[model samples]
Target: MIVDRQGRRFRNLRISLTSACNYACTYCVPDGKRLVAAQDELSADAMIQAVAYLIEAAGIERLRITGGEPLVSPKLEALLRGVSQLGLDDISLTSNGQLLTRKLPLLLETGIRRLNISLDTLDPEAFRRIARGGDLFSVLEGLDQARAAGLKIKLNMVPLRGQNLDQVLPLLDYCLERGFELRFIELMRMGHLARAGQNFQQQFVGLPELLALIGERYEYAQADAPVDATALRYKIAGRGYFGVIANESVPFCRSCSRLRLSSTGWLHGCLSSSNRHYVGDLLDKPRHQALPALQGLLVKALGDKQELAFAGGTTIMKIIGG
Candidate 1:
């Protein structure tokens, strides 16, 4: 296993297919501030080869395909097909659900059985405002299609203080009725949101308050997640499972088993920093030579993995492929 110096084995690999996106979420890639890679992104074959080497060398079994929005990448389907053929234990995708309705069949055909959709609020106006001109109806249609496709669905919600907090209980009800897992991520002060003028303090909400509110209404118990998983999961009795990814309020750095690969093939050990090592160069080497070289860099990087600092970063969430 790819155990870091701290003894955290890295088993999950998150790869970004593209830095392009459709929705302009306020907390993520805000309006007029999208950052696409200047360097050409690795092609489907190259991505597969790189990931295959990592899977073998690092013993990474679980793979997650992310992006500014993964569906935007034309090479996504091919990439997924190639990686799935490697016999990886799990393969999942994280998307905004904008174009997912039409691509559901292709996604499943390409071997992605699990999906995480970014759906912050159930309200249409709130969605548009928060997502900066996103269509809530289209996302709903995508969700319907995903459920019909028999995919394990998880809704990733970032609860802003005054924005989606009102819809919290309603969102829970919706997820429970549909048997979908709900993950509430605390509003992180990173990238554009870290600006002094962004008023990030006003938008922040702690996980404790959310848990207390949910506990008051539902009979929920802490559910066991994988040792390396970041989210603290809970199963609300007779309803469905929910998770609180309190990265800031209750940091899960000690158990983080993820290493993110950007669209341009940059490797990031931490989510809060823009300092990424260029792993793409190793892809140019022959398979036999690349494996050992890539493994060495990964081991050195993991050895230097440090706890995250959530303030003052220019790299947007899309570029990091979170």
Candidate 2:
């Protein structure tokens, strides 16, 4: 088992299968004229093999499949099948919910038990604006499909100050009425923001304020949302449940129990920075050597995990498969 300096055991793995996405959310992958070539991505088979090795070496019991849009990958079903073959304790996916209407049946058949759909706005126009070219109705249909397939679904919303904050109550009403879990995530800094001269520090909303507002109308239960280190979960008084991911305002690094593997084959010890180790290079080496190297790297990285530093910057959530 890999233990961090704070004694948190790493038992979860999040893997990004691809960086390509169908939707261009303004906050996520804003309209950029030039596209980064896709030559750097890891092949599906290599990803599966690496995950198998990691699970064996670290005893990771939970796995989350993520992407710019995981459903955008044609081989998503096959990948899920491979993950199931690993006998993981839990398997889930984070998607944009655009293609889910057509893929939900196939996904359920492949052993995916839980899903998280990123839907930042409840208004049709607002959704189109935030997601750039997304259809709000398509996502709603996808949610219905997922529910019918018996998959536990969670709505992931990124609350921006001037953007979708107004839709908070409406989004909660929709979730509570439909009995679906909803999560409100704070915007975070990532790639290109620094170069673009944008301030990440001012882009976040305080969790206390958001929670206080919800508390006025609902009761929340604290639970875990594994992908995020700063997630505080809750269950609506008489409605359903929801979560708040306050990455910028509140850092939960001490309790972090997961590691992220990028689609390009880099292992990130922490998600806020670009610091990572290349696990792909060790693929050609013997298992004994590769496993120990991975463990040592994780141990060292965890020992060096940065404390909460709130400087403004940006990284594409899609690139990191957040």
Candidate 3:
């Protein structure tokens, strides 16, 4: 395993099952249409092959199934079933929750214990505005269904300054009441936001500002988090916990033990860096031929990690697993 100078190694892997998504989230894409799968997306068998190889080559222990949206991917079941049989220490999924209810049985059967659902607000109008094509009612219903199924839920909210800024308190309150941890992800400088500095500045909500808003209603204290955990967590006494994935203001780059795999077979060591290792061809080769080459690519991926802060980049979050 390649550990950076900061003493971080790849134990966690995020796989983008497909580049395709059903919702045109404003923060994800500029327009209303959903992101389409890449023309040269790898097959489900190919992706599973890569994951099997990475488990041996990179010493990956945990897997987070992501996507443009994993639920919409035709290969989701195959990927999930294949990876589950690999004996990973942990396996989770992150989605927009649009199809959670419909996919609940599949998830439960495949052993998905926890998940992160991206929801910006509780208000119907604002929800529709933020996620152009998704129905808020359906999303909420899915969340409820997942919860009832005994799946631990975390709600991921990216607070935009002028848009869902007021959603901070309400969303947190909603999560607390329903036993879900609300993770406030500070707006990342990616995709279209990377090119438009002014627009990003206008919309970006830092961690401090977010805490101030939540502090107005909840009395919380700093809480312990796993060393490589992305979110800096907090607890509000009798209520449940909430977290902040403050990539900008309180960057967790030093202890970021994550590697991302795009559906097209690129391995990204750091979200802030553009370096990617293509192993699509390797996935097709015999194990003996692939492992030696894939191990070298793992080293190059970890070599791209920054020692401290995350300097934002222009990679579309929708293209890679966000």
Top lDDT prediction, candidate number: 3
Higher-ranked by lDDT: 1 or 3: 3
Clashes of 1: 0
Give each model a TM-score.
0.93, 0.90, 0.98
Per-residue accuracy of model 2 over 1-322 as CA lDDT, tens digit each: 7765557766888898888887777666656422232678877777888888889777788899998778888658768877789888998999888888888878888888799899988799888778876688999998987787788888888877777778887888888888788888877666655444445444556688788777777767675555535578776556667877776677776677777788888877666665677888876678888888878777755654555543433556677678
Supply the global lDDT for candidate 1: 0.82
Candidate 3 per-residue lDDT over residues 158-271, each given as its tens digit: 999878998899899899999999999998877777777788899998988988888888899999999999899999999999999999898888888898999999999988
Please identify model 1 stretches exceeding 4 Å from their true place. Answer: 32-39, 195-198, 307-313
- Candidate 2 structure lDDT: 0.76
The true-structure Cα RMSD of candidate 1 reads 2.0
Return whichever of 1 and 3 wins on TM-score: 3
lDDT of 2 at 168: 82
Residue-level lDDT of model 1, residues 1-322, one tens digit each, is 6675567766889998888887778888656554454468888888898788888888888899998888878888789789989989999999999998878889978878899999999999899888885688999999998898899999999989888898888899999999899999988766778673547878887888899878778988899997767788999777789999887787777777788788888777667656677878888888788888777777765754555534445677787677
- The per-residue C-alpha lDDT of model 1 at residue 1 equals 60
How displaced is residue 33 in candidate 3, in Å? 2.7
C-alpha positional error of residue 185 in candidate 2 after TM-score superposition, expressed in Å: 0.6
